[model samples]
Target: MLMFSEDKGKVKFNKPLYGMTGKYTLAEGISLPYFSSLLDIDRAINELRIAEQVPASLEAKWSLKELFQREIDEKRVRQDIVKGYLLDPKKLKFFNAITIVLMPKGADDKILDSFENDSTIPPPTIPWEGNDVEDGQWNHPNARIANFGGVQFISIGLSARLRWDENRVLAVAVDGQHRLSALRTFREDQEFGRSGSLRTHEQETKIPVLFVLLHPDAGFLNVSVQANYSIRRISRELFTDLNKNAKTVDKARELILDDKSINAQCVRTLLTESTTEDIPGLLPLSLVRWQDDFNRFDTSYYLNSLVHLNLLVSEILELKDKELRDPMDKKQVMGFIKSINDALGINGQEVKDGERPLTRYYLEDCCEDEEDPHTPFSRLPEHYLDSAVEGFIVNFRPWLLRLLLDFKPYQELLAYARQYNLIEGNFGKFQAQTSKHKNAILQQENTKDSEWNKREILIPQSAINSMKENQWAFKAIFQKAMIRLGRIIGFEVRSENKNLGNIDDFLNFLNGLYDKGILRVDASLPDHSYRLWTFIALNPGNEKIKVNRAVEDRIFSLLRLWYFGTRKIQIDTAAGEQILSNRKLLQFFAADKNRVHWPGCPEAYETLRKGFDVATLYRKDSNEITIEEKKELVRVRFSAVLAAGLPVLSQLQRGALHEQSSEYYNQDNES
Candidate 1:
């Protein structure tokens, strides 16, 4: 039996355990003695139990059990471990320690009968064997107890061998439950040859473990002592200390910290170099809420958050289809990256570092099988990344920035803020104060009635009210829809198409509608039934804009039809026939057949009615046309319509910016 004791000889344990003993000082007067060891795979899987399986009495006291450990994610166990680490066990390595709390078996267990029956069971004592020992009563041969200025210290020369009875104790893992679950799953899978079978030698793999004892008078230890705190209380404190402080990286932080993704690299460059002389960034650092996951309704000071911006960058680079967790098709991804580089005017020869092609910029074999390659810019030459970032700034960034800035509400908000001096140079500081202002209003207590409540009011009430009034314009979904519209109309600023004529006309028309309150999220409007925004964007039930892909797509299609009709784009006979017979557009326009009214201007409705007449003519002789022919005909008509509108759409004048110079603020003196 192995034995261990504290330096002052206040606490001791005697059991058959194979590990080194140490004490972790939690506070000035409180410390927990721990046993660190490497347990064989089989032993750890069998011996250790999760906190939920502990005896009812012990479980009841540990009210923090749910908070202490998370439910084991079975998907993580199967995919990340069984399919990842265990796929090759010979080179397996797990550096993290599996932390477990040791509790003595309850009174019901027969294993603890000896300790319970005997009121004074003698603690197992081991004699020191070294000649250097004076009393030969030390826990270790090379141990020495000394006093340094009234403080006692004990030293075990190299390592302290500790022992613990495995059967008489209950072991519960407080941390690394996922890893433990993975181990258990791997072992079970090995027995059935499910996930690559492990050989006999591989099955004996050992993992690091840390066993902690919360109380000195633990029943199985057969020792009696008094302490200020119970085992359950200490266990709860330890669990909270471990988990509460360990922060999980949110989406915004992940994007900021990412060094591999080309999309992330571009986003970071834009945010950091917002005021670069050569190509001024459209997305100012101050306006971006990079720390937030989603834009809060109450906090409308920022333009957009990191998550949406990253997605936009991906869409611009044609990398939106691939997710970070999805398996990499290296060859396909490399080809796509090469195309993006070519379009950006990066000939791969511009940047030095062996003067390689765009495809050769990144490492050929930087990742393992089944792992995501992330982006072609990952592990690329630093000079090439710089060139790539520059290319995006010059070619792609301007168009996207223009598209976002062209939104009437964004323009008006910026102008209003500038005119009123609501925001100075530093956007981050202003955003922080805005958050404080929101909090003060929410908490409604503790905040004094002095300038403490008004000191951070950088954004005036007028700007806030304006933002709240046009809330739909600042929505992530709305911006995403705009980007999609830009792509559809071939206005995605590229090297070849520098002129944003077509996109400008479309925005002006949309903004005109916005100015007339057609896009307002109010179901009580007199023209609610006839409003195009109602059918396309706003949810009638909630009187709020529906923020989903389906709604976004419908918005694009309906807008495209309106734009084409307004521009009077001509279509071929066959294609025109198919467009008129388009049941999707027909159903959308005539949602309530009882009231035969179109949503747009009378001129546009007349144009649509004339087109519907063509469908009537085609329907009389429609028996001859097949379904496939009809689909192809409709696609041809849509393409022709977009092409015909392009020239005239670009020639249309850009819309003038509108301004609202109204200031309204009310303060409450109630405290």
Candidate 2:
């Protein structure tokens, strides 16, 4: 509907002379099919989506002027600076075109000459201030990390150069287009010693992209059934609430039917009477599909499964007792599930990611077609663990994911995962790559709004040693929250490894430092802070998890702040007191003592001891979890290292500097 340049000219392309280029493809061939209607359009779009067949013979002379609102003040009185920025392409440098020899599917060498004669005066470079470095420097870590391995680029041909009002815009390849465009444009322009704008700057930037060519009417970034990116905008609080619906449902399930509830005996008869397994809260989260089908799985399905899974698991723990851990860890269960499934080989897709597990981070990587069993998912009991459900969790995920190519469902699933605290590979590692790593497809092109949705990941306590020594009091105060959130273990994080590696890697040293008031780790605010953050991103909510980063930064910052070699007090507090302060010291003591919030009433604790209806909510399952609070709090009071293990820490610190040389023994990537 919108177009800027409609110029039609007799622009004659140079002849394909064998003498001029040593290659001869004079055989005339026509190859352009604008797919029409429902089926044919889909087919045509599908074929052209991947293929780049711009033949010399089929030269449709497009002399249309590549137009733009050159001067910002022209025609449209773009007084609203925000609107101008959101719609500005010249400012964003999102415009790019790939000129490549299009290779046919499964074909090599004999690539069809695509974009052979498509060169125009204005090159397809992202116009950043017409010449600024920041234009291409947008951080899209979730986008393709690299295409064809190392090169952060992708294949994009001249599909369609549609017009938007006064701007020339691209219309196809929604995902990875930015990255591809950046690469193509950078590769096209390079001078000696002078780095031709190959990469973008560091800080993340976002521009509102309007779909001008794809759907002329599609003005906003509306999500489609095909390639959805961001989920509908939900507040961070609401997102957490929506995700925690499972918890609410789970609570209702227990209250209505659990033996500990008021209707202990008669609730079963009142509910289903079928062993009371179909309680509301009990649900397996795997029912959620990876595709945006109308029949999307909800918390209801998850609740249903939990009703049964909980009943079975609770009974199993009572029966198998000690084997089942105090904390219901997925990794342990996954190992158990895999041991049973080792015999029955998984069908469908098999990615050769050598060491990683075969589950989606959500565990839907192997989801299968819904099967009607004798009972609902909530009523299946633990028998499924030895039967089809076991096979489904272990085998079906990979099978189902192979076919769901539509990117939206995956995005939604990931969005949901981040909304809730369910990170870890339940579905498979592929899900992690898809949802968290954000490095799947690297380049500015592959960037999306969902990429920024991950607010932060909670930092693990094991890595707390990496945070600066000045922050120890802070870290100590926050250790309780970290342990509760699985970010830390009270005394030891790496129980087996002990002090075998770098002093930093050793949980004892990490804990000792914290106890000695050296590392200052940030404490998560509340549900509001953790709302949209997944474990992939370590913000304030995950500062503890990225303690290594904090530590690394502190060491370097010290070097810059003070001339090096002058201070021998790497662990000493007096010399390094420039950064630390009395206010933080007070906060540390307050946090360490669990006095951040006034401990007015012991109602929750007393209620638990008295065994009230919601007693379990505030109760600690074990002493190991409860008794270590004081130890962790008092331990991190900072003190200078007396030079015992300084040499080893220095070496480990150096290795960390080189992006390798980890404390973990024999890690493949350790420098």
Candidate 3:
């Protein structure tokens, strides 16, 4: 086995990158443990032709039968959607082969040198709302993909440290990259102006990242990493020299079935190992990590970090007192982390296997790199999280889950491998992306790690729109608002009654308060007006005055509804789980400290005075909300800045205002 110290540096690889550890075909003077450098990554990649072509030349020319098979396969492929136009027997000669003319020296030399200093080549993403383009270059003129990350241009680069024994050449920008060709087409177009922007120029506006070659190769070489124009996964020879140093998911694994606890008989009884409470002793479990079998490399530095999490858990739980048994505090640690999601809240997310109280869709991002044998998550102490009762982690579960869980509403994440699969399932090219990975998900950790680690986060088109519309603002404003409100409402309100159905019911309760004499002030109007009252309370212009009847009904109703009927989610995190009341979050805005008469026109409150006079319904049909109404609601949901001031409107408030025109009725009718 290649020891840690001798491995040079990290070289990424797809699972099972090369054959076995020792199996590799290096033509002529090709070396093993070749290190990559700034000047060599691209060179090493293009050099594969020498290793492969030289070996292929020695093989006898294809026999008649072999040639016939190749002909048939080509014919069959020619009729498919991807190649029907190219494989027509007429184009076959021109299809598999490309004519190459040596560019008289100095061609593109300037462009090549410019890229040398800038290794990070952020190629243009296809804008979803691609506008018009000339010659079909910038905007994906070909309606092939759905969005950015779908473009098929290959990224040939190197990992350079010590060039001789630790070099790596990666041919990436594959699969998911081409999926967004459609979107990249529009965003890169300088012509995509406001005059007629597709969806008003909502996508990223970046210059198309054209590939540059500083050291240009003149001979015709096959381009084979995922591309619409290339033969998929078909290289005449496997990448051997490049594969030896690549690392894929590779780790130890054990099925920890200790019926006798016999395997652990030697464990020290004096250990009082709290970390292994559920296991009762150090448990035997399969340890796995993604291997670079596809390109070929591995590592142990990843393994050390994993062990640290276990040690941390053990140290925290090793208190001498018997009462402090399990490190339940781990839950507290977990809670401190945020949900890794940028989409809507995870209310409907489900689990395929056992149930974890908080198996959120956002948490799915944490295990994205499970494909890499050395993927950080694959090494996490998950076995500890395996059982329902007090169980020690398997190894590296917590650290990985915590890292992802810490970034709530995914901060425009880049890709991680395992997540790419889940994401593909929802959108993009999910068909077959998973490829029987579930059973393999846990079983082949060492096999899939490299692919999992390379994925970057694909930001949602909708979120990009929000940022664009808000001048680069994010929805985190709501999160801060939620946090602020959650802290101020005493977290729990006391009520004499329960059974409130929803926010609407809470509003009705406040209305009920006004019907009874318990609420003072403007009792001239009947039914609670919780929406209007709360707005008045929170509105900066409206200060805390004596309890007015207009607000009394709503306040009483809100108190009754939240104190007794409100339900809360038990947010589980590494810091442990806590039952949080959302009602408290609403109260912060309505608190007395916020009531004032400074920010806006106080005249807005006088709109309520018209309610007593305008109590009669002039038009009864205007109040109805239909399916069409709901459709419009959906589009406006993200843009609708939760209007809560006297001028603002909540869903409940809108529903209530739509019911009866309080402004039309006359006060004399009741007396």
Identify the candidate with maximal TM-score.
Answer: 1
| lDDT, residue 292, candidate 2 | 24
How much lDDT does candidate 1 score? 0.50
lDDT of 3: 0.23
C-alpha lDDT of all candidate models, in order? 0.50, 0.25, 0.23
Clashes of each: 3, 69, 139
The window of 10 residues in a row where model 3 has the poorest summed lDDT is: 96-105
Better of 2 and 3 by lDDT: 2
lDDT of 3 by residue, 112-161 (tens): 10112112323223221234233123233333211111112211123111
Q: Indicate whether candidate 1 or candidate 3 has the larger lDDT.
A: 1
The TM-scores, one per candidate, come to 0.49, 0.16, 0.18
Per-residue lDDT tens digits of candidate 1, residues 280-379? 3355555567656764332456656677888777665664234323324676655555555654444333332345655554444334443555433223
